[model samples]
Target chain A: MTGGYGLLVADLIGVAVFAASGASAGVAKRFDLFGVAFVGFAAALGGGIARDLVIGAVPPLAFADWRYAVTAVLASVAVFWLHPKLHRVRRTVLVLDAAGLGLFTATGTLKALDAGVPPVGACLLGMLTAIGGGLTRDLLTGEIPIVLQRDIYAVVALGGAILVTIGHRLGLTGLGPLVTAAVLMTGLRLLALYRRWSAPVAVP
Target chain B: MTGGYGLLVADLIGVAVFAASGASAGVAKRFDLFGVAFVGFAAALGGGIARDLVIGAVPPLAFADWRYAVTAVLASVAVFWLHPKLHRVRRTVLVLDAAGLGLFTATGTLKALDAGVPPVGACLLGMLTAIGGGLTRDLLTGEIPIVLQRDIYAVVALGGAILVTIGHRLGLTGLGPLVTAAVLMTGLRLLALYRRWSAPVAVP
Candidate 1:
């Protein structure tokens, strides 16, 4: 498509996955429906909204369109209804979350670069966007954020963002480069999960 | 002085009060020294930092000005050294917190307007700046944010922000109006606390 629709599809899918993860996490933490909805909204749009606000995009995503709200609501409902039955599918959920993280990381890098942020800053925004939701969710539940201590979580996103930044500067083929970055992030994340890899828990 | 420097000095005093509240809250919550410092930092700068990032101001206060970091650290250290001795001063601490809340509420309102935000949004942002840190602190510690489930938390800041907005619009002179707004908020909050007022708990 010669339009923004293609990217919008990816963004929506990413939103759904992020919301689902948040809702499921909320359920596990024994939060009420409102709390679940808050987590879902934070997970899905927190990063994008933060990025947009930073770039001075007025009336951010929370107010921009109804779709974002709809996605969060739907995700919350889905988790509220299905989480009990899906408890065994933690692996599947993790895979879906990894895909969403990859998608959001790409979106962050692209949006920041589009707004004229420098390469390093763009990458930083990308990683922040990918991890911000999870961080908020964890913090709200009185747990250490996974990003601050996890299996190649932020590092994978940072690596992908760096590649996206470099690719944009080098005038690389868009789809080819995007796929490379996304696959790298997703693959690394999944492998880390499967291998039970984790960062050292030393206090710095 | 026509220059805002005079206003800035008053605001710094409020910031110091805010730092003390943050440090004490951390101590009351059983946080270690590092946690106390983090809480103090969050309490002192969380609001302004959020405002700056949302407005796309680069390198937030914690990084740009050494004073913010110094203020948080000093407050944390002071609390660490004095908490045991100051145990009898719980009432005084609450009074100081009220005072800090007033100062922060006023400064938050001014800062949001100075950034050229619309009246309603600016007012909301101002309130957020005043109470955002405490909210984050409570949530991170697995308690309901005082703002969400307490009497007159958001409402006070809202009033302060609106008063300041209207005062500026009417070309009101001096710090009188801002002070009035803060006093209103702080007084109301203290009343709420003294009366043991609370929001009804949500039934799951």
Candidate 2:
């Protein structure tokens, strides 16, 4: 597949995983079906929408493309009905979430760069795209964002984005650098989880 | 002043008030100066950014205009330094918040209508504009949104937006209907607060 097509596929998978996570959160909160769907869609699209808006991309692709909405809603409905079974595979979900984070960071950075954003701004936008969905989900569920509370989540995304931005600046084209950066990001995030590594809370 | 210029001035005033409210919340949470300023800017611009994105307005005015940023920052700094004295006049802040809500709703609805949105969609956008900032503030502070919890806040904004949309459809142009709608909305919100009125919670 072409590089662009590969990125699109990765983005859709990321959306599905994020939607499932959001729907799970909604179910845990005892939200009704509509609420679950709303949360799921927000989690899937919020990051992309924010990125698009900041870059002056009108009518965010998530809103314009029917496929995104359909995918998110399907994921949400599946979680709503099959959560008990899904809950048994908590480890799988965590792994998929790491993958999603990596995919979004990579793609978001590339998009921002394509829009002529400077490297540093692109890196921040990439991190925002990785975390914004989960932030919106947590906010909708009335909880402090886990990103702000635990782990090196956002930092990991930023690290991946930096790699991508540097690769692009070095004339590394196509899926080679993108895939490498994504895999590295996912692996590092998993390692962080396994090692119980976390960012510091506050200064003494 | 022309209607558009008047709207711009009203929007700047709304930004200042919303920034102050957000800064006050940050102070209550004991956030540092930077955090308070960040929250202030977010509250001032979040609603307009959301509205601009939804309507396909590239480069949201809040981000493009230096005046908006300067106004919000000034308001935040003022509040950060003068909060103790400002707190003595709690009623004034409440009244200003109502006026901000009304002004945003009116202007948001008009902007949506100008963008060719249908009446219902415009009204919803207007309500979103009125409440989105406060919702962001509450989320950042780790609290449930007041609009969703208690009070007729969103509903009041929607009412004013509906009136503005109706007026526009009737070919009532200029600042006349917009000002009237805003005044009516502010009055109703104040009355609702005084009378302890609130939207219903979930059904029993």
Candidate 3:
């Protein structure tokens, strides 16, 4: 029960943080309230939706569970009101974004395992779940995807996903494994952020 | 057998045309060959993939059906070799794009119906199948979606989807109704293109 509760809390926090990032992007683009909400929802839920669809889990849990949608909306509203202040704390946002990334990667891998996806596929789905929402958000705002451009973002997510998927395949499906993966993922992301590590851009 | 062959032909043509447009976008952006291929595949098959996932069709047909993947790659290669000349025939590309829109919308709606989706959901799926690829393509290329910016693009697809969905709901699933819907959709898209119709943008 505690494990399930912890997972739920982590998932909700991830959703809220991702939604805020998306809403910030919408606000930066001067989108209207509806537009902000749309961006936020896409960012919070798009990755999971994509992962679920690939695994044939219909009506994606995001749609089946109203709390996810509500969380995204509330986050968007909060950002809409506090965007200027939020912008000033960009470092904090980045930290939270990394935390969300770790949470999502772990959760996504777990869901894919539950759906009986192969380890490799589950790992990919986990990474997708971590990066997909941000991709959607940036794309909608006419910006290059951050995952494609900077930091150890997707790479870290991919590592976490792979770790979790392997753990699951090895019959290590519990809070301990999940927490370890999430912590490792979050730590790597933050370290990369502070250390200014980036994926190499292809020379044109 | 004949009906199945014809549907296959139509689907391939749509994929090729959409792939061409995506490859053209990649070429315009001076992307690498891999990037061009990526954009082409996304543009050609992303929509159907999205639609299939929403309806619980796991492991999307594009992944399961090698032919679809092959067609997209061939189209991408063709574009890479012929983009300069192809770019000169902008008008022809527009016409082909409209045709693709109509074909995908019809086929997508039919697939949704076959999957037992309700009429309304089927119609939405059809429209999504038509627009989703182009949306992904444009967004990835850092442009506002053409469907949202100019022409009666998505609107026409939605109209065609509604017509086909309604026809199916009313037991009018014959080729005659489907063909008529496709023709009307293609025609409306062309008309909108030539007439410079635009979706209303909200004033900031």
The CA lDDT of each predicted structure is 0.73, 0.85, 0.83
In order of listing, the candidates' clash counts read 0, 0, 0
Model 3 Cα shift for residue B56 (angstroms): 3.8
Segments in model 1 whose C-alpha atoms lie over 4 Å from true places? A1-99, A112-125, A147-204, B1-10, B25-42, B56-82, B85-87, B117-124, B135-177, B195-203
Residue-level lDDT tens digits of model 3 in B67-175: 7777997898788777767658888888888888998898899889989898889999999999999898888788778777766788899889988888887898766
How far out, in Å, is residue B165 in model 1?
6.5
Q: Ranking under TM-score, best-scoring first?
A: 3, 1, 2
Please state the error at residue A82 of candidate 1 in Å.
Answer: 12
Compute the lDDT of residue B150 as modeled in candidate 2.
87
Query: Can you give the lDDT of residue B26 in candidate 2?
Result: 74
What residue runs in model 3 are displaced by over 4 Å at the alpha carbon?
A1-3, A32-34, A56-58, B1-41, B62-135, B144-204
Residue B174 miss distance in model 3 (angstroms):
19
lDDT of 3 by residue, A1-204 (tens): 215777888888899999998998999999999999999999999999988788777788889889999999999999999887875888877888888999889988888778766666677678889989988998888776656444678889878988897788789978998888998999999999788877543233
Query: Candidate 1, clashing residue pairs?
Result: none
Clashing pairs in 2: none
Writing each residue's lDDT as its tens digit, candidate 1 over B169-189 gives: 888646777777778878887
Predictions: Cα RMSD each: 6.6, 6.7, 6.5
